[model samples]
Target chain A: MSAKQDNSPNRIDTKRLTLYALLVAAAMVFSYIESLVPLFFIAPGVKIGLANAVSLLLAAKGRYKGAFAVNISRILLSALLFGSAVSLVFSLSGGIVSLIVTVLLHKTKLFGIVGISIAGAVTHNLVQLAAAVLFFGGGVLYYAPVLVVSGIVCGLALGTLDFVIIKKIKTNL
Target chain B: MKWRDFYIIAAALLIAAVFLCLFPGSGGKTVTVKQNNETVYTGSLYTDKEVKLDGNTLVIKDGVCFMKSAECKNKVCVHTGKISKKGESIICLPNRIIAQIE
Candidate 1:
């Protein structure tokens, strides 16, 4: 199918809007599923960040606005549904930082999708750690070693999954 | 994965290894508990004591420290098990509690 034309710069096309909504919903579901998994024993507050795959895919497709909107909406909705105020702060900071890094790396075109995803994952954990330090003092830095390692491992898994899905779908939208 | 992707992974692993080297092992003899950025309790790791905070409980025993219980939702702190290292910590973010072996 030919890509839909955007007749006006001010208005988003209907298909794009629908895609963004679906992405947001998928991101939220991923967030919920991640929360249910108990991986905290490896490192306190460590998450696989499966929800990031959605935004990463959108960002990879050069839909920066859709990625950003879907990510923010997912964070806010998930926080409201299953998180507290503290989690909301962490999620917001991590989500925004990671998304920005992913978009920038994708724009560079020097690295593969896996590289962008890994960078985003590491940045997300680091930003959340900084936020924790800001709130609870420097003691939280002790968790840095484990968080970094976990981020890399988890990011690699998520990135590979995204890469295959992206290749198979091959949608221009 | 591309060559650049491998580079990114290597760089990240290097950073983590650096951090791991910086904080080597469990050599601390003292346990410190902080709530809301205030030091509430500090004691020898050799002493078995249960620290009761506003909403959390920390236990230090047999040269190790752990969260015996907590009032937070996730219980991540409690699940952290034990730590006897100098820079190891059990953090309960929801309750703003940090129990560290220092």
Candidate 2:
């Protein structure tokens, strides 16, 4: 089956649009829930990347455009609502880099959902660190070790979630 | 799912762990506090002291430093525990303060 069946600009398929809108809404809700969870005490800016799981699901289903759209819109909207301009920058950098890494890793098919999720998590932190260095200074890299550890652990948990969810939905999807 | 996938995850985790273990050793004994891109205080981690800045206080005791108090809402710095190694740091983003062992 083709990845995208609709090419006509004038024809707006309500069903596909509704599905994509639902996915975006789901991603936003996950992002909102994640913000509600107080994770700062654990590590500054560390998160479980719940919305990324949705993106992973889309990527696994070969809906790359949908995944990217959902992930990007989620980041922008969440940041605007729940964070500052600085946070918007941080999430944008991290989310974009993370999406790229997950997509590339998923394309390779050399790794499972767990591995792709791990890579995405780690890349998110690293890129956020880079953004920190760029915006803050080189001194921020000192947080790298902790971020790495947090990234791996959170990735493992979220990846397992993604695995189970993907497995359960595999037949229907 | 596959053996290779398991290996990939294991390897990634091993690398992260190895890095965590190795990084702390590279930190120096000097502790520096920075705010707004400026170094505010430089001291010895071995010397127990208290640093007060912009209503935030960092307490260093027994070679470990932690955010004793902060005005931030989350108090993440206060909850981030302590730092004693060279590379370890407690960052209070709300206050724009970073206490690092270097």
Best by lDDT: 1
Give the alpha carbon lDDT tens digit for every residue of A8-58 in model 2: 643336675677778778888987788789799886677888888888887
Q: What digit string (tens of lDDT, one per residue) describes model 1 on residues A52-131?
A: 99999888888888788899998999889888999899999999998999998889898999988998999899899899
Model 2 lDDT at residue A107: 87
Q: Score chain A of each prediction against the true chain A by TM-score and list the results.
A: 0.91, 0.87
The models' CA-based lDDT, in order, is: 0.84, 0.78
Which ten contiguous residues of candidate 2 chain A have the minimum total lDDT? Answer: A8-17
DockQ-derived CAPRI band for the predicted complex in model 2: incorrect
Residue B49 of model 2 has an lDDT of 76
lDDT of 1 by residue, B1-102 (tens): 789898888888888888667644333257889999999998767556789998988887767888888887789999999988888999999999988877
Give fnat of each prediction, in order. Answer: 0.63, 0.28
